[model samples]
Target: MKVLPIFLLLFYMALDGLHAKELPSNGNDEVIFPITELQIYADERGFVNFSDVLNGEVEFVISEDFQPKDYSVDSYYWIRFPLHLNNIESKQWLIEFYDQTIDVIEAYIPTLDGSYKKITMGDHYPFYQKSFDHKNFEIQIDPKLHGEIVYYFRVKSHTYADIRIAVRSINRFIEYSLFEYFLYGLFYGMIFIIILYNLLMFIAIREVKYLYYTFYIFSVGLYATCVDGIAYQYLWPNSPQWNQIAHGVFLFSLIFWAMVFGHRFLNVKNSAPRLHKAIWAVIFARVLLFIYAIVFDNSLFEYRNIEILPLSLIFYTGVYVLVRGYRPARFFVMAYGLLFLGFLIKALLNISVIPFSIVSYYSLHICFLMEMLFLSYALSDRVRILKSNRDRAMQRIILQHKENVKLKDKVNRELERLVDKRTTEIQEKNIMLEEANQKLNQQTAEISKINSILDLDNWKLKNNIKEILQDRLINKNLTLEEFNKIFPDEVSCFRFLDRLKWENGYSCSKCANTKYNDGQQKYSRRCTRCGYDESVTSNTVFHKIKFPIEKAFYILYLTNNRQNKYTLDELSEMLSLRRNTVWNFKKKIEQAFSDKEDSHLIITDLFSYHINKKVS
Candidate 1:
């Protein structure tokens, strides 16, 4: 609809008085008109081409509204302003464009002979291409060479560009340029000074908050340079593409550091932890938007108003913390308050709510300076409050120490009197206690010697029984009860698998990592390198078998025999399992180890050798 484009145009109408000048329709012999201020009047000629204007097919609506046209990348704006060069004798005249960030400007200068001279100028071109080596585009006018002429300028930019143009004499332009550059020097110099001071403070105190503020201030200065075209003129004159997105990049940096610094300085993590988390979320969103602007659509960077969210959030946090009686946030609140006022003033100027002036136009820059100063004060003020509290704490500790010393002296006097009386009795009791301890030690030594002999016998019995049970498992067909002696339950079977699977060494199948710790599950090793959790039964013939592992071991022991000792129905009865399920697993065991006749491989060998085969 018409609403969207109209809104963009209105929002981006940066400044007034860009242009429209036309030739007085006088004959070629002599063309002149009376003028006092030497300013050209223009009309907004929308979407018309140079050919149409040259052929006299277009009618110009001469009005004061014909200022520097707000830029929309989709449409071209032509300013048709008439120039009346009357009584031109010696004073030199030139057209100067105030907005240096216009992407393109096609200026058509007319001559007395009904012909025009075309000159191309814009920030899109190299800085050296401009006739004047200044931030604003300027074209010298030869007034004596032509009588009457109309000037047409085609203005377009990627973002909002101030379209204000002023016709100044050569001397006047020089004076204005010098004064402007001087102010720029002061502005940027102050920013540089602030950055240096904060850097030193960061080093001296080792507080990261100062460092964050320094970066934020640096970003603000860089964004200001991008906005005023000083960066394009001086820093990267040869790189026109960088000039287009410089403002956007620095603006994002400014907001990013502002959020971080505000979060730290306000101690949001301690005071408002929920909002502290919200700050990180907003920061993540801003990063995503910035990346999308850079990679997918750079024009999205022109949506500078999106910054209002973070700025308002920071301002609200400052106010909220201040309301909660945070002393340091007072100055922080004031700083952002004035900064928002600057944004508001600039917005008002864009909407024509406020009259245009240098201060109003440069409101943001002025506010940035004030905000930096107040924030620095806030940092120092926070330190002051902390130091004051620490000193009070030290004073309290000293008073408490004196009281503790007096009590210690009184207690020491009473203790000395009590110790004298008990000393002789304590010595006599200690002598008696030593004699009893000696006798007790002699009895304890004899008892310990007897106990060690019994422990040795107990260990020998347990080892021999284990060896016998293991031998019985290999030699004879194990009944379910006998199998329980070797693989008593699922846990015993799992331990056998755990030891049998990694008898050589552990290695991860996924990453080939050879190191591991215990996993969350029992009998499972977690690989240290790849974090792969491998269970004991993984990749084994018994994997996913529904019955208990001890039953499976019993079935395997029966199957490992030259003939299966137990019939499928017998195993179903003994293990309380289905006949078909027992038969299926008996066949799997047979296929895994049926290579040799009367093979007597131990139950542990079955797990290691046939481990690669999985249950289908």
Candidate 2:
């Protein structure tokens, strides 16, 4: 029975050795397992264990594709490669995985004791727990392999991971990593310098376009680091899960700021108006996509090719504006053009359309560098063109000033010549005017005596007419037109009240102060001692009347006149006031007269002067 088990083991080893490749002896030797050399199997149920794989229960299929891939995120991919490692005596060897973004990796190596040893490593764990302090996944093979052995690596990720395993001697791995990090330094250094320069430009120029460009390039750098695992190793060494989502975060920022910067720099709102509205729509859509990726499904972040849409739109906007005769858009077009090509090459690589290489892998970084330089040049070129236009305008103004100065000099000379001729003509006219002036002076003395006599007669005539008009205001038979002749408006009525109420002297209504300054009103007085203001109508029967002062003055004049025969309706029609308004005012005046204690004095005249004796 033991012989039967040894015979079965030998038979299985013979079958596996047929597919095994020889492990190199030199530590400098490097080898890559292509799709033809490796066998792939997906654990769709994720329940297949190492015992099933070792017992030859699971079937593995060889892929004809250029690179092996974990196509579905819902399953685990088990990749097995048979290697003749019986000759690993000369130097050390390690398995290196190129894709650092894989969430989990389990390497199962066959031991000389005829059992499989398992090792688990991935970005899901902290960086401090990593076997090798490097960006890529590396597993060191022990020198205990007896004969041909099959190595199995179970790859699982939330996103599609490119499965490329390179078997390198320690010497080659060291050389390759040093050169890669060196190139990364140069790449990031240039980006840093460009970002710093653009940031300074934004600060100095105070333009929003420069600010947007600065943030766009910064996002590019951060995303590149996240893609290659440099950020996991150095940025957040403790948090490996962040390595998964950093790319999506930075890429969202990258395209977002790029669209914004392009909009302003291209002057797209004015240049391509219809397309201008479309850019914002695309931005809105991109934002919605990013939100969905974060909140619901982070796997959507792996759809990096979606960025091509916005970048293409930006490129088209640059072209459209440039074709419309916008000269500053030249560098802008070149910048986005290279960027679009980089994304194109990357998208092609994702599908195995382009061969994977160091140059091909970092193509986006190179294009980002080129695009950064061109965009800075674009901003500077715009400023240069604007300065040229301003300089030309200044030159035109200077030339116009010179022309105006010559025209003004010519006008001054013509005016001087005209003035000389006019001066001589006026001198001759002065002599004739002086001789005529003597005769006019004698005639003026005779006219002056007659003018003085006429002015004195005119002054007396105006006074006699004014006295008669004022005197007729006391007549009861006067009509509305006749009453207006003495008090035509509120000003005339207030003036009469001012003169009649303060006929003897001025007095404050509240404090009865004899001294006062000018009040706020025209015919009102303010007391100097108590500061009380006595208006022209304050103490009179006309105070606070609802109708106009002249109308109230007319009503009072008619009421005081004993001969007045006009009824309330007739007075209302003549004064154009309501009957009740006219009647109410008449009663108010009568009440003032009835309130006076002096029965001997005329009612209207005595009532006004009763309290303060102001109208006496």
Candidate 3:
């Protein structure tokens, strides 16, 4: 059995060697083959068959007699070759040939008409110059290959030669096409997610920072896709107009985002003035470049070159600010650094210093993604810092509130002390006022008692004078002098009585009635009120009392002014009577005056007058 396998292997090697050296021939500027019929068969018996000439027939025909007689051998050779295989594990095959005399031989494969390959031939005897055209080829079997498989072969006029070529070009095209599609889908998907995420952030934060970041991410995505040729080849194949415009759009967007993001990230206003000025200059340059691109389309390349200058300027400025401990500057430096590296790599590739391949094409986009991730972290850090600042402000407010509360408490206590002091002072003043009022009331009562006593004494004296006048009137012949002598203790009383008798009514005693009153001799009443009366004694003690009538009328006044024992002795001398008789008359008059003072009528009238005066 082993010998059988060895003999089969040797036979296979010899057949392969023979096939390797076989070459098709052309006659009369045309090529022909000895075997014309070809067929392929396969069955379930694990066997495959290729029959080029059925029934061992070598019957083939070539009609080359119609060729022009002047045609050269190089001009007329034409051939068709068909290849088929069964039970073939390889998707590609090789054909070989050799030629001895011809310095150059051309072979053509019709199945792969649009394809070209070079073949070399080796020297062999009989000057066996071989040429391959359509006539010498035949299909023996159709080989089964997966995925866009086709069969084609080349022939050469050589004794031995080797052909090495791929027979499945269709599969490679399909694989590359799918791979590029996948990359495009993946890139766009990431861009979509970035847009959605940034949109959400903008809504939640209501911050222009988020808006700038969104545009930055969109510009980055466009730049990456354009650099990769994905946008031109797959996304918009027929829109060359869009492709040309995309370049300027991408550049403009990039610069705009850089300017906006730089301002937000660096807090340019708070930075050093020179640094801030430099940043503004970069922004101005970007604007000039954008405007230049719009006004002059041919300046787009110049704009792109100018953009790099500003980018570098912004990047270094941001680095400076960041190193100076500007909080936002740190994020800007990191993000711009990533973008700058990406752009640097892409620029180098575009200038052809670097090979155009997958790694070079995707390097910039990957860097951009890294930049975005870093920026997100920076934004999160900024949010944390803002929150911390807000919390500190709130704490300050709370502290201020606490201080206000303490101040209010102190003020309230002070006000309460003032109120208490004021209340105590008012209470003390009220007590003092009450004591003063009590003293005033007691003084007023004592004054009222003294006035009542004086009024009662006055009334009693008046009544006593009136009683003496009535006694004299009853004794019609009694002269004023006699009456005064009898009642010397009441001399004023006697004078007042004489005046009452002379006058119809009481009159002034100091100025006596004169003129007609003195001339009247009739015994009619005569005074200021009436004419003078002859019965009225002008020099009698009654008319000429030592004291005034008002003072002398009161008994207490007489007693208080006169000497002791004068009531009776003085009255007897003035009246011309005995001392005992004068004494008895004086005593009786004093008793009547004292008795009248104690009467209820006098006391009641004095009290009533005092009460009426108080009411009025």
Candidate 4:
């Protein structure tokens, strides 16, 4: 696909050459001159007609009437020759002239005789003369010369041989010119695209290499254009002053781009830092040469020659890289090789050491075109390689991400299991705590019931004591000791008196004394010697007692043991006492206990009977 265009271009070059020719028009008459030999004759009279050259060294005579004119003067003369023929024929030929003084001059074959009949020279007429013999011809010269003149003429054979050669030459020139123009357009277009594309790449990637490559490509393109002569022909034809400078600039840029593009393309540092530095040194030398050219335009030729040395170095470096298996270096070597060969050929041809022709002019451009195509392909290959690697890397990244997700899921599952186990353990502990709380609540309820029973027993025991004290009148002279012996297994007699005293100590029952008897014996025979037959129990709890002390103590013991008021009532029934009497006894004892509670002193004295009994 790529080679097709090159083939077509070559085909056009060939065809253009084959078909090219210069045709004669109606106003131009072709001339043909025939001569056996050219000879020079001289005579004493200076009148010479030395037309025959085979007569042997004839010192031909010259007419004294002729005056020699200096043909060295800058002037022009119109000359014509007639061809006598039987039938009208058009002839085309190229006239060749050799002269050391051929200045700006124009010549054309005249198609008509007497075309300028009125035009005269100094003494003769300017007109073509017809020949007497039909096969013979006459040559006419206008503005006749007065001195010796030398001129040789021949007709460029328009025959097949000559035509073929001329057509080939002319066509080759045109084809080359057109091809060069095309190459200029192509390379310039490529340079523009490269610059724009790489500039955008630099912006997008922010890679310094892209910027360097952009500058390098631009420089290379400019240098290539200039070296190819396309810059002169198309870009700056009228600017002759820039010609030398353009050459220097082209060489400088070529070396610069060579170094930069090579360094970037080959990964110079990793591949060959020493070679890279050498290449840069060569480039720097080329830069110096360029500067010298700028500073001394007159010595431009010398500086240009100096530049070629660095260019040679660069070429060798490229060759080394390419041989070392640098992939891009292959293209670089190929392109630079073609360019260098083209330049060498052009230089040889331009110096006239070789004939300058169309093939020579365009061969360089074709090579350049080939170079550009190869370089572009190389760059495209680089892009493809980069894209492929990127895709692979992206795939790897995606796979890694998927693996990471799987690992994360496994971790989450493990964490969830741990959380569930912890929750279950906490729930079990809460249940155990609830059971323990329920047991504690039952224990608390039983303790409350036991306390209530103990309270009831205490109340019954206090009531029994009150009943025994209330029977004082009926049980006169009944000593507490005797009372205790009657209820032997019950409260002691001293305890009964202590209970009665606690109830009636503040109120004298016989005397109705409200003052407490602090010194009175608990079982005194008479209340403070009253001697009125009043017993210590007179007007006290014992005065009103109906139940026997022994039975009452038994009931108290039973009630205190059972700790139930109902048990006390049953016992009373067994003793054959009225329920009302037992009940009244219970009420009076409770009341007496209540009164004792109010009258008892919370004494701090250690010798108090209350304090001593509490300790016992």
Candidate 5:
């Protein structure tokens, strides 16, 4: 029980030693102190008033360790630093937080009237709202160090709470900022050169890869500027909200364009399909984190936590490219390695894992510059490789074209030889075809002569039959040629028909009257006794015949002589009449001879009643 009490006393003593921190007291006009030497207490609810801390109601514990603080917490952190000055006169002092992204900073300083004068400064407020017109958060302290001088800082942030506090003389602040800005100027100059160079390349080549890389470089450069206080100082001095989220916006943009550059630079889609898909997944993750940051404006640190997985995957993408024999990734890996080292050292320094120093503080900038230089070299090398590949492709095309020309020449020669052979064979076949055609024509002419002789013999046989069977008037059996010569026209045929029908005089069929006068119609006659009218064809087999009279006479002559039994087609052709007219006239002639049935009437006998009658 006595041993446990001794251990408890020792533990309490150790705790006291850890919480005690004292500033150096010297009669100096200017001095600087880091945040490590301060006492800190986190006010979870921020309900503790300054009066409570001053009235011993709340105790201030020492800050975590003698290093920088770089972690995010929801609670408000109250940092107390004890200042000891041995001067009786009032001296100028400054307390500044080097990190620019802190959201709110409240400083409680003890005044001569035994009360605290509060000063607020942060990027969350406008740059002009800061107590001093400086890029970083700072408060001026002019105090007489007689009894006790303590400064309380209430710090809050949406991102990493990098509690990098610096107490300095006013003059020291000016000198430090000048040096810092100078380094920033150099860093930005290099980035500008790279951006301009690549932009020109993009314009000259019109390559999408160069364009993507140009934007990636611009985003990275903008992100670096935002991380530093230069953007807040100069770019948008009045825009506190933009200053607050600028880091997240540029960071997400950098991530997106960097992945796009990687995908194009590595030719991943064509070379490594699976890796290309993984790159897209990383890009999607970046977008989600960006969206989350926008939704929860105060949860940027939480968004960063989600971003780690994709960032790690992006690193692994470089490794995958290297393993897959991607040539560009050699430089890619080197550049990323340097960048990773710089960011790691800076992170370690911010978290107090490594002591804060000038080199460690600007490690990210140094690494970024080196990375940009190496990447520019890599892009140049990529252009060289592409040009070389293009030249080789052109050479291959030219060689293939030459071979095609040779093959085409060989094919043309073979086609010419084949054409000559085909021509000779065609000529021989044409000569043999000509001989066969001549023999066929000779046989055709001989058959034509034999056909003509057979037709003449048939005609002579028809005449012989006509002489033996028909009347003597048509017994001469005029051929179609002789009939056409004797009665070549309609008038001659009409005269012949009149002589055949009314050889003695005109007659009327209605009353068997012999005497007739001229009727109104040219071929009609009117009877003087009975007033009956008659025409040359009105009462004969030719009655009501609308065809030419010459064709009727030839049909009668052919029928009387029995030279030929004409079908409608044959009669129409022989008499030059329509088939229907010939059929009708033949029907009327056959009907006229119907009373003499079974008595084969000759053409003259069939119409003798009309021809021989004289009613006078």
Candidate 6:
């Protein structure tokens, strides 16, 4: 049995020595493996001792897929590989885990004496706790292995288990770090410029929408930095704990501000109330995720699960609003479409739905650059449109002003012609009025002579005759005998009054009917249409007079003849009536004539003649 064991050990040693001569390398500067060739064992309970892996007690399975793909599991993973250094002259080599977000990593390298050299490095621990002082999880392999030496890695994470390992020479890693940082700096510099420009726009325009976009851009830039591992190397090198959670925090912030930007830019609340509510729902989910990140120390695993929900909802609602005919959404849709494509590519890669490549790794930043430039163009386009509208409005106002000026000039010309025509008419009327005044003076002189030749009673009777002539007795100077001939009785006097009142034919006061019947009273009439009784004097000054019609007409004639020219006592003495009775009769006639001067030509001309006579 001892000879068999010794022969087996010698056979294994010779086979391992032959395998060591074919150590993978390309020109010896660095060896870039397409995939990590390792035997992996998953410890589902997460409590498997490292001794079990070293003692060969645990069963190991070879990984078929070496490409970086997400593995969501609660188990700890053990990865074993062999480092053959016999073919390479230099023994100094660096083993680096490319992914920055992995929580805990433990490396176990076999020593010549069959013991293991262990090193712990991951984002979960402080920078001082790492095996190497580098941004990524790096470990410098011991330079003493002469044959095929086995290496082990125990990996665990609260986030995605997406591991990509690389082994490079020290000088090559330094060159790679410088070049990678340069590219990262260039990317961030572009983002910073966009942020600064938009911030200035926000200040200049004082629009909350621009401010929201600025914050969105800033959060996206920072999140991209975190995702690319630049933030861990430079921004927070010492705080590995912060570096671990930075991705989740910045991602949540990016989505939060993106929703805010959409809300203001789209005016969704006013334009689409239902869609606005959906946006709020997405925002609420983002808030809950943000709270989960802050409150739960190890919430990164949960955050990664629903990381795309907020942006997906925002994109969906944005397209809906655009389809609803919001004009401002035109450019927004184009710009966000590119951004969403970038996000889709990255998210697909993150979930292992797509393979990793240069396109998948840097496509988001490229799309970010495109989005920023496009959005800037969109803003400039909006400004151009606003300026065009303002200029058009100004042109319309100027045109309106010119039209008003032309209209005013035309009105002025017409007014000048009208003024000239009116002036000529006034001059002709003045000449006619002067000639009429001379004739009136001559008539007054004749009337004075006639008055002087007559006695006081005849003069008074003549004045009463003048009043009657000036009334319905047009153009006729009549004596008392002639008046008696025309209005010989009370029935004739009342009939004359009725004819004067209804010269246009009788009409009902209420119904406005033309036909009427003879009423009971002498001056009364009844509407045939409505059977309503109406007296000629019903709405006149003699409406309820107890005096006889002839006497009432006489009294009115005396009152009209006297007017303001004589006192009530003088008129009463002339008419042989009481002072109170004459005064009351005078008031009734004056009241009847009030406001009727335009329609009643008899009273209007009589009053005008009296006024002219007094003025002359």
Best by lDDT: 2
Q: Can you give the lDDT of residue 512 in candidate 2? A: 76
Model 5: per-residue lDDT, tens digit, 336-374? 677667766765665668876778877877888888888
User: Can you write out model 2's per-residue Cα lDDT over 1-616, one digit (the tens) per residue?
Assistant: 0112455556667888888877765444888876555788988889997767766888998877535242778888888877777553667788888888888998886665555667888889888766799998998877666577668889888776878888888888899899999989998998899889989988998988888888888998998899878999999999876677889999999999999999999999988999899999999999998998999988788889999999999999999999999999999999999999999999988876778787888898888889888888898999999999999999999999999999999999998998999999999999999999999999899999999999999988766665554454434356777556656788867776776778899866677779989989978888999988778888678888878988887787778877788999999999899999998899988888787755214434432332122211
lDDT of 6 by residue, 1-616 (tens): 0112344434434544543323446566565443345567878888787766654688876566754453645878887665666634664677788777788898886655656667777777766676655667787766776666666789988766666667777778888888987887788888888889889988998977778888988998889878876676668878887786787788778778878887777788888888788888878876875776588654653446465666676677778887887666777777878888888887788777888787887898888888877777766776777798899999999999999999999999999999999999999999999999999998998999877878787867767756654553434333335545545677866666666688777779999999888898776888888999997778777777765665566556544543335567765675467888777877878776685764346844543354234323
C-alpha RMSD values across all candidates: 13.5, 9.0, 41.0, 38.6, 23.8, 17.8
Summing lDDT over every window of 10 consecutive residues in candidate 4, give the lowest-scoring window. 158-167
State the lDDT of candidate 3 residue by residue for 450-553, as single tens digits.
99999999888766665554433332333335423433444434443454454564343545544334335223244555444443434332244444333232
Per-candidate Cα lDDT values, in order, are: 0.76, 0.81, 0.50, 0.48, 0.70, 0.71
Q: Rank the candidates by lDDT, best first.
A: 2, 1, 6, 5, 3, 4
Error of 4 at 126 (Å): 36
Instruction: Compare candidates 3 and 5 on TM-score and give the better one.
Output: 5
Note the residue pairs that clash in candidate 6: none
Error of model 1, residue 477, in angstroms: 50
Question: What local lDDT does model 2 show for residue 544?
Answer: 83
Runs of candidate 1 exceeding 4 Å displacement: 1-47, 63-73, 86-89, 111-114, 351-355, 404-616
Q: Score residue 505 of candidate 5 by CA lDDT.
A: 65
Which candidate has the highest TM-score of all? 2
Those runs of model 5 whose alpha carbons end farther than 4 Å from true positions after fitting are 1-32, 63-72, 86-92, 112-114, 143-148, 296-301, 340-360, 389-616
Per-residue lDDT of 77 in model 6: 83
lDDT of 2: 0.81
| Selected candidate, larger lDDT, 2 vs 4 | 2
